[model samples]
Target: MTTYFVGFFLGLHRICDQVMAIKRGNYRKKKVSSTSWKKQLKSWSIRIVVGFFALSIFWVLCLKFINPPITYLMIKRGFQWQSEGKGFKIEKDWLPYDDLSNNLKRAALAGEDAHFMSHNGFDTDAIKQALEKNQSGKPLRGGSTISQQVAKNVFLWPGRSWLRKGLETYFTFLIEIIWSKKRILEVYLNVIEMGQGVYGAEAASHYYFNKSAKSLTKKEAALIIAILPNPRQWDARRPSNYVNSRANNIVRYLSHYEIPD
Candidate 1:
């Protein structure tokens, strides 16, 4: 999997460089012989296409097998959250899809990925935006949707390096291909890191709402989703003004967003 992404990224880098050169009108001036250049371009094109296909296939396979316990292992090995100074703890108690208010799903999806149902695994536009913004300063935008989060929590490690990213890409493809939207959302609810040493919807609800996962109110659910971006610092129980503002925005938009029957 590493090998595949390495090749794919390299191929993409070349494509980007070539496109930049073309934009600068230097592509026609390069002396590397037309025949060789054409052949190389064709080869890279094929490779990029094939690599993406293989990546999608691998992601589907992993969804069928790989799970979130890998996150537990990473935590057990003393992987602390660097930014927030916290650890994650998971507790499982599956909430029936009905018990939770419909707005909860809308809030999470809107907060994370508005187009979650449409994208396969990755949101290229979101990634592109993140890249551009991160280049100017520290990265603030994360393009990961519920599906990718589900994959990361269940199958991938948290190294925050190239290797972890590569594995994450592979596993993101896995969950998108193998699991239903419901399954992906379910696992996300059960495994997402909510606070310092706090994980799973049940744990979060018990701690924040003084209730079970099944009893979380729409406002409470919105609060939970609001703190997800940086659960270590943000507290759903006592949200800052920003989190509170975002939660209300989610509620305002909820009626338009529909949940599947």
Candidate 2:
């Protein structure tokens, strides 16, 4: 142990000597100016930050508009005091466009954002309503579209924090400019959390229906859509009477709107 410590100290001393020599050589030679170093650092810093955000945005955009793997709903960390923290595993599964019915689409849209295709990215009217309701001591009206929700779920954390909202807004706009409407719907459907540890349509289908996402029925889809408000609290397969009524309402409302198609 004594010899090991002495050797370790000697190695550290040699490494320090090598670093000092390198610094001395740097001082002796013509070096990059501090201003230039700062500029370069700032440039690289911007590139790193922008690159990270841009790539995440692009991945979301492509996954939304194109047929690809659902990007956001996988659980990385387990639950603490919650219901034993549920997470999902994607093992060669894909949600086909045909498998999801129109009723399900409209129901999801109605449950999430009523005016999905009409707005750009931000739902200012809904935000205003949310704010107004908050002021008036009522329930908040969320104006977030499928894409905005995708942005929040995929890119940003779940919260009512100002910072998270700002970042979500930024990502929402970025994805709107990059992805199409169809892609947004696809991503939202596939990435939504259906239950504890249950994520994506495929995982939820397997957990709830014992089938694939593409084989899901209208009733099954309605049940899934019904629990969108709070997936963790309400089970989709065995929903309560209120959940059934809400699902029925979504189905009824869906008949009036042409959702996803």
Candidate 3:
């Protein structure tokens, strides 16, 4: 799988470089012959592709052991809030998989991805359902799995562009191949935005309930998970009727949720 991706990326990179070279008049300029340009482009492209692949692999491998201090989303949101003069400060604390409450994990699985333990990286059934709903003229929805969410939150920037989506898919496969399920869940809980300027289970627990994540009750965990769809818009600290209702639904679902061993 890794070899296939590397080869594909290299092929894509070579095509792009060739197009760029042509656009820059390498084919027209008498100083460089077409044959010479082709050889040079191939050589340089191979070198650049190898360098990028090595660096990417090294980075992903390192994350298996080292926790990231901050994510691109955190920095981007922080800058935006600062520009708006919202007095935003990122509050986050990294907790190991065992340190967080079981309810929180179960609640998250219940609220976000019910088949998280089974799905590889994408959830086909959820995607098919979303497509059907959209076709029926309902509001558009995403079928992004927990793995994809972690990929976007940890490595990629947010957007709906094809380029962004493609990169998200690439990273999703990488993490699923390299990191364990527990590690993926731990990273998701620790980095996912819970509220404005609040991140991670520990930070969210403290911000909303003034307690540690491990001490959160089932209801509290559900409430925290309820605002996940739009944490900035939904306030877990002062949950509206919709948020409260969603929390209740999540709690009910939690009873049937089985945490992956």
The models' CA-based lDDT, in order, is 0.72, 0.73, 0.89
What's each prediction's TM-score? 0.66, 0.70, 0.83
lDDT of 1 by residue, 1-261 (tens): 999999999999999999997866765566546768999999999999899778767655654545434365336533545334545433445465556556567767767777777888788899888788788667345777777777666766555676777777877766666777766776677677777667777778888888877666778888998999888789998999999999988777766665544
Looking at model 2, how many pairs of residues clash? Answer: 5
Q: What is candidate 3's TM-score against the reference?
A: 0.83
The TM-score ranking, best first, is 3, 2, 1
For residues 132-172, write the lDDT of model 3, one tens digit per residue: 87897665478988899999998889777778888888888
- lDDT (10s digit) by residue, model 2, range 138-164: 544476678788888767666677787
Which one wins by TM-score: 2 or 3?
3
Residue 190 lDDT, candidate 2, scale 0-100? 72
Candidate 1 lDDT: 0.72
> lDDT: which candidate is best?
3
